[model samples]
Target: MEEWTIEINRSATKKEKPNTDQLEFGRVFTDHMFIMDYSVPLGWHDARIIPYQPFSIDPSAMTFHYGQSVFEGLKAYYTPEGNIQLFRPEKNMQRLNRSNDRLCIPPIDEAFVLQAIKQLVYLDKDWIPTAEGTSLYIRPFIISTEPFIGVAPSHQYRLIVILSPVGAYYKEGINPVKIAVENQYVRTVKGGTGEAKTGGNYAASLKAQELCSQKGFTQVLWLDGVEKKYIEEVGSMNVFFKINGKVYTPALNGSILEGVTRNSVIQLLQHWNVPVIEERISMEVLYQAYLDGSLEEAFGTGTAAVISPIGQLSWEDKDLYINDGKTGKISRDLYNTLTRIQYGKEKDPFGWIDIVNEANAVKQ
Candidate 1:
């Protein structure tokens, strides 16, 4: 619907590409980034792709003071056919608008933004890794740029998109991880910014995450703030538990960010005739199920780590092991299936892959 201007980064030279086998997550970035400015009466303008560089922002920027910002994470896969594709990117754009509504920011044109992303991805197509379990990570974010110190929302905002080449989320490749349930530190309560992909929610979890990491846990398992009984989510992904031959996940009870991969996992489960239930699940109940030896599989789903199996969970000094502390059969199956479809190695029956580089995919 709208056009995005392309500006090649002159005087830019490609660096030695990292060995995909040794690439860590989100450490290296591509040569270019997409940026747009937003101001009242003028709306969002000056959409362009430029060399990736630091932003010039005042110290009193609202995003820094009041934490008024939101971001989304997605990935581009280099298919076997030499094609690059994005999986369910529209969902990320829609979620961005939802986050904007919650943060008192202006909504963006989803179609236009998607086109801009396609153009950016196209420009950096060479940076898309083709190694096994490697991909180009896409981070799209909006920040309040108005250099004012006040309690109200900032008037000026900036939307930016940057790309990074990443290796497998887990160095061991689909290995199960350990998680510790957080009881003292709460992530967020209902009717809070928990549902929104804002910075504060993540910033708040850092301390707890640090504590958990010190205890050798991979990530902190968050609980709802109000009750602290119902399971909310993991720090980086929506979690799912398979017990007694059924799949159960913490519903979006106004406190969990709806994950695109989580939804895809659910859909895939249903399509494969596996039962899935979305509802409140307390840690006590889950532990009880574990005691009864019914907890079959536990995994967290996110864009970064598509499916992270939870081998062991520590709650209140008690450890509950899932599937003998190894990746479960279902977890392995889902990971293989989802990743196959992602890399275009198999036929996409869900119609989720969107090819970039297609004519009319992005307007000039």
Candidate 2:
């Protein structure tokens, strides 16, 4: 195994940290960031921590035209005991490599990069918010930096990690939200890049999202591209529906992004002896269930909101109000349990918490 060492470069002038209570999602960033470079023969090299300032990339960079990139989102929480910890960060690292495979980017050393993330978070520990529903959002992304216009994959890449103190992902917090079902625009197909956590997948969603947002919807509920019948995703999160007494979410169908929070919610449901199923769930079936009063609740799960209750889902001028347009029991419970575990208020039986040792902080 090759030894990977990250060189440290502290920022001379630190930026003002935002007020925790007034924090919004991804608006305010911390002082330092982690970066690494990769090329054909060198693999990944020049790992370092430096000031959070933008560096110039060539105007004709491949990433600008070819859109070859991948990214991951996770967070660090401030425990009541004055310690900082991450919630299942290894899963994010593994997912990043999976995205890399889809994008034809070089694989990164997951363990080493995870260490660098912890060190970077710990180095800026003061930026970790203590307010409820607040956390230090961590973003790890890779961009094709080779300044070439050809269609082939780039020979060079840059991986960078930046931190932001964020509040609730949705303005509603843990409350239920209204979503618009999209039938015209497709997110991705089974054999396409939908499963990859790349910028193109999100870029594909912007049009529908914008249209839905104009109609007073919080997010857009996407249907599968091939048929436009089965449920795929809800904006950026994986969706679930509770009918009768069992919970069902769309299975990993290669076109749907596998979400870390979605997996955790499934595990938690299983742990609680709740029946949760992963299968093809169609909007017609869901609407019929709602008509028969069997569709009890609906929610979307992701690292951002953890769990966003679906108050109402509108499709073809019909509004399916879930749980009377209020937060459902299951949704509230999952949010509370997951968040408690994240903030270190509840016992972590799943061994998901990774503690960041403050003692490892590099001196300025």
Residue-level lDDT of model 2, residues 109-141, one tens digit each, is: 999899999999999888998877789999999
Ten contiguous residues with the weakest lDDT in model 1: 2-11
lDDT of candidate 1 over 96-131, digit per residue (tens) = 999999999999999988888988898778889998
Any residue pairs clashing in model 1, and if so which? none
Per-candidate count of clashing residue pairs (backbone under 3 Å): 0, 0
> Judged by lDDT against the true structure, how good is candidate 2?
0.93
Best by lDDT: 2
Q: What is the lDDT of residue 44 in candidate 2?
A: 96
Clashing pairs in 2: none
Question: What's the CA error at residue 40 for candidate 2, in Å?
Answer: 1.3
